[model samples]
Every structure is written in C-alpha cells, then in structure tokens.
Target: MHAKRKTALAVGAMLAPVLALSLPASSASAHGYISNPPSRQAQCAAGTVSCGAITYEPQSVEGPKGLTSCSGGNSGFAELDDDSKGWAVTSVNRSQQFEWKLTARHSTSTWQYFVGGEKIAEFDDGGAQPGATVTHQVDFGNKTGQQKVLAVWNIADTANAFYACIDVNVG
Candidate 1:
C-alpha cells in the first residue's frame, strides 16, 4: 500500500507540466478566419493580398436625446464618429499570406474604416439604418509566430452608439 501511494504521487507530478502546456493562452485579441490552408501553391495578389478567412465585430451607439424622433435617429448614435478601434492576434507561418474583409451597418448614417490605426477605406450608406456591410481586402505581408492587427470604424454621433470590429488568423 505504501509503494502504490508513492507511485501515484510521482505520476501526478510528472503530468502537471504537460497538462499546463496544453492549455490555450488568454488574450483579448480576436482571431481572424482562415479561408485556405497554408500551401506553396497559394499565391497572394501583388504579394499583398492573400487567401484567408474573414471575421466581423459589430458596434453601435445611442441616439441623440432631443433628436429621438429625427429621421434616421431611431438606430441610436455612432461613437468614434471619425474613428473607432478593434484588435486581433494571429499565429502564422513565416511564409503564409492572408487577406481581410471588413464591413459596417447603419440605416441613416455612413461609416469610415481604418486598419492598423491608419485610414484605409470608408462606406456611405444613406441613413443611420442597420444591415449595412462594408468589405476590405488586405494582405498580411510576411509574418512569423503571432501578429497583431487592428480595425476601426467612424460614424456620426446620436443616441445609441454603433460600431463593429473583428480579428482573424490565416496559416
């Protein structure tokens, strides 16, 4: 009985490190979609855009107080009227390539976009309504290990705030 107990304790200690190493890392960054598997046959456009999955994060704001009844004011207001921010982290092979598509929605308003904190694109939907989607394609460039990416949205201010940001990975 003493021998059996000693063996059990030794086994438990040996397994601890293996179990801990298998756990996933906790990070606030979002993961992007991977549309295609990494392969030598894969080619990027102008060596900038690559094949990869796309993910989206939605955001919104409150409508203006007195303008509640105003046209297009029903869907609340948009914060970051000029710029909103989002982030993501991805693990990639040294030679892997990827692209991204982003979108925004508002019934009575228009929204602009930025990547890596730089203005890259914009969309003007007529009103501040919903269901509006914008798309952009970007190349991951050359990267290894884990990489960080950012997306931002800009829209007019009102009552409710509106915004969406997403991150993805391609390897």
Candidate 2:
C-alpha cells in the first residue's frame, strides 16, 4: 500500500503542471482597469463599494469595441452601470492623469475618453504593446461639475476593448 501511495504521489506531481497549463486562465489574469481615480470596478475591487463578482475581478470588464456603458455591455458586471451605487468621485483639475493597471498587457490600438456621449480625448497607441501601467493626461476643456468619463482600451488584434468609467468632479 505504501508503494502504491508513492506511485500515486508521483503521478499527481507529474500531472500538476500539465493540468495547470491546460486550464483556462482566470479573469484575474485576463486584463486591466483604471486604478488611479478608481473607476467603478476598481472601487468594487478595493471594497470602496460592496459588489458582486466584480469585486474579485475588476479587470474583466471587457466587451466588443465602441461600447459606452460602464460595464462594457456585460451583463455580469451590470452593477457597474448603477449610477445610484454611490461611486466615489475624484476631484481633479481641468487636466487629470488617468492611470490603468494592466494584468495582461495586450497590444493596443487606441485609448479613448468620453464625456456626455462626446469623444473628449483619444490617444493612439499604434498597435504597440503597453507596459504594466499606462497613464493618459486628459484635458477636460470647459467641462466641469460632476461627470462620468468613459475610458476604453481597444485591443489591436482583437475586436474587443476593456472599459472603465471614472466619476469625477472637474475643478
């Protein structure tokens, strides 16, 4: 029985790495989100607001490109679209530096920012792969008061994009 147990242990050890490699990567390893100024998902992940699955996987708010919703049209993260959730609003100057903390940095196409359904800023990455962290300095122009800034990271090779909505009071 001891010899049989030893053999089982050996087989288990040999299969461990293979099993790990064959398993799909978790959403936590999939992508990224706005960290600084804390987008809705970031707020969930940080426990600034109580939430559901998103609290564990803030970087997974990915969907097809050109989505304007905070949840990126993903039903699972619909809590992000709730305006009454009391999402913390950051106070910023006319120009604010938005930062993304990436988990799996994919090749990029463009970074876009929108306000009131109007495109306010866009930074073209030209299909380059970004580092773990990306920062964009967005100028709010004359826009002020409470605003929701939708940020999108379009993947160069994929038809999808990661989305984040930052709530802010532009000073």
Candidate 3:
C-alpha cells in the first residue's frame, strides 16, 4: 500500500503542470470591475451603493460579448441590470482614462466603449493577454450629460466578454 501511494504521488506531480496549463485563463479572470471611475458594480463593491450578491463578487459580472444586460444575465447580480438603481454617477470628461481592476488576466480580443448605443472607442489587443490591469482612454466626441458607458472586454480565446457599465455625467 505504501508503494502504491508513492506511485500515485509521482504520477499526480507530473500531471499538475499540464492540468494547470489547460485551464482557461479567464476562469479566475472572474473577479474584475471598473475601479478608477467606479462602475455600478464598482460602487457596490466599494460600499458606495448597496447591492445584493453583486456587492460580494463585483468582478464576476460577466456575460456574452454582444449582450446589453449589465447583469450579464446573472440573476444573482440582476441589480446591475436595473436602470433605476440610483447608482452614483461619476463625473468625467470627453477624454477619460477608464481603468479596470483585473483579478486575473486573459488573452484579449478588444475593448469596446459605447455611449448611448453608439460605439465611442474600441481598443484592439491583437490577441495578446493583458497584465494585472487594463486601461483605455476614450473620447466621447460631442456626447454629453448623463451617459452610460458600456465597456466590454472581449476574451480572445473565448466567445464571451466581461461587461462593465459605468454611469457618468460627462462634462
């Protein structure tokens, strides 16, 4: 029995690296949110807004790349999808640097920013995995007043994207 246990340990040690390599990079990429200007989730995570489950895992509010729901269709975090949440609106400019607190990194396709349903800026990562954090400075052009910035982080290896909805009063 001791010999058998030693053999099992030897085999298990050899497979650990291979197993870790095969896991999707985005699996732990789960916890991430807009931190600089603070999205609704960010606000909740920071205690500026009272939220339910989303306040606990703000970084996990992810959904498909093309979807518009802030909840990412996650019922547990459905409060993010509500437009009447009284989320604190951050004041920003026509050109502002948006920052994300990435708990894990993944190969990225592109980062898109939208205002009032129109694409304002898109940053292509060229299929490169990002570092611990990601930032994109955008120019809103002629847009102003209360606007919701839909930031989408498209994973290069997956068909899904991480979503962050930042409400800002553009000045």
Candidate 4:
C-alpha cells in the first residue's frame, strides 16, 4: 500500500505540471485601425511638383513602426500646392486632437512641412543616410477645418527620391 501511494503521488506531481502548461496564455490588446486611402507610387518631378500614384494607408495612433521607401528614379518628395503635382493632405481632424505617424526614405535628405502654403516644421534626422521612418504629432489648435501637411526632401547631395506613410490618427 505504501509503494502504491508513492507512485500515485509522483504521477499526480507530473500531471500537475502538464496541466499548468496546457492552460492558455494571455496577450495584450491590439490598437484600432485608421481609415485612409491606398498605397500609390510617386516620383519627384520639378522642384515644386511630384508625379506618381497617390494613396493613403490608415494607421494606428500608437502601435508598431511603419516603413516607406523611394528608390531608383522615383523620388518621394514633392512641393505642397493646389496643383495636381504636389504633396496632398487629408484632414484627419480639424481640432488637432489626434496624432499621426510619418515615415520617409531618402538618399541623404531632409523633409520640410508646410500648412496652408506656410512652413510649419522641418525634419532631417540630422543628415542620416539610407533613410528611416520618423514620427511626428501635429497640433492645429481648436480650429475646425482642413489642414494640409506637406513633406519635401531638401537634400541636394544626390538625387532625392522618397515616399511617406501616414499611419492612423490618435485622439
């Protein structure tokens, strides 16, 4: 009887560990999606114009980093204008209560931002090469209207070609 009880105890101990391992694990919640247009190819044209496919991808206000690139003869930088060949903007929110992600790729280049044809901010990652994505949160106060955000690569060392990915808005 004593030997039988010891074997039963050992079996219970092994089964206990197996039962614990079989339990399901928990995971973190995922962020919601942002509604934007599709991805389009774009190339830099004149100093104040860009031509190619145009689309937007909705992204999370807070989540994993996104990627964008422009290589070969295709440049991603473009001037912000009302004309057909320039950077375009779609207002996510007029009150500026949300945040968005902007990622770009350029061959030793920088980006310039404009609102309503006026310079608002400029970013270059301190002259880094091979390019990477940079996130920016914009605030437009409590006003309600369409605000345009333009990205222009200002690098002259080599031909600048790049594209931007604007993720979802965070409110």
Leading candidate by lDDT? 2
Ranking by lDDT: 2, 3, 4, 1
For each candidate in turn, give its C-alpha RMSD to the true structure in angstroms: 18.7, 4.9, 4.4, 15.8
Question: For this target, which candidate reaches the highest TM-score against the unseen true structure?
Answer: 2
In order, candidate lDDTs are 0.33, 0.94, 0.86, 0.35
What local lDDT score does residue 113 receive in model 3, on the 0 to 100 scale? 90
Error of 1 at 5 (Å): 82
lDDT of 3: 0.86
TM-score per model over all chains: 0.28, 0.84, 0.82, 0.35
lDDT measured at residue 2 in model 2 versus the true structure, 0 to 100: 100
12, model 4: CA deviation in Å? 84
| Model 2 Cα lDDT, one tens digit per residue, 35-143 | 9989999999999999998999899999999999999999999999999999999999999999999999899999999999999999999999999999999999999
The window of 10 residues in a row where model 3 has the poorest summed lDDT is 24-33
| Model 2 / residue 136 / CA error / Å | 0.5
Question: What is the per-residue lDDT of model 4 for residues 1-171, given as tens digits with 9 covering 90 to 100?
Answer: 999999999999989989889998542222112112211122121222234322221111121112122221222222211234333334465333222123433333445544454555555655565323344444444434544343344433544333333222222
- Which of the two candidates, 2 or 4, achieves a greater lDDT against the reference? 2
List residue ranges in candidate 1 displaced over 4 A: 1-108, 132-161, 168-171
After superposition, the stretches of candidate 4 with alpha carbons farther than 4 Å from their true spots are: 1-109, 130-132, 141-143, 159-171
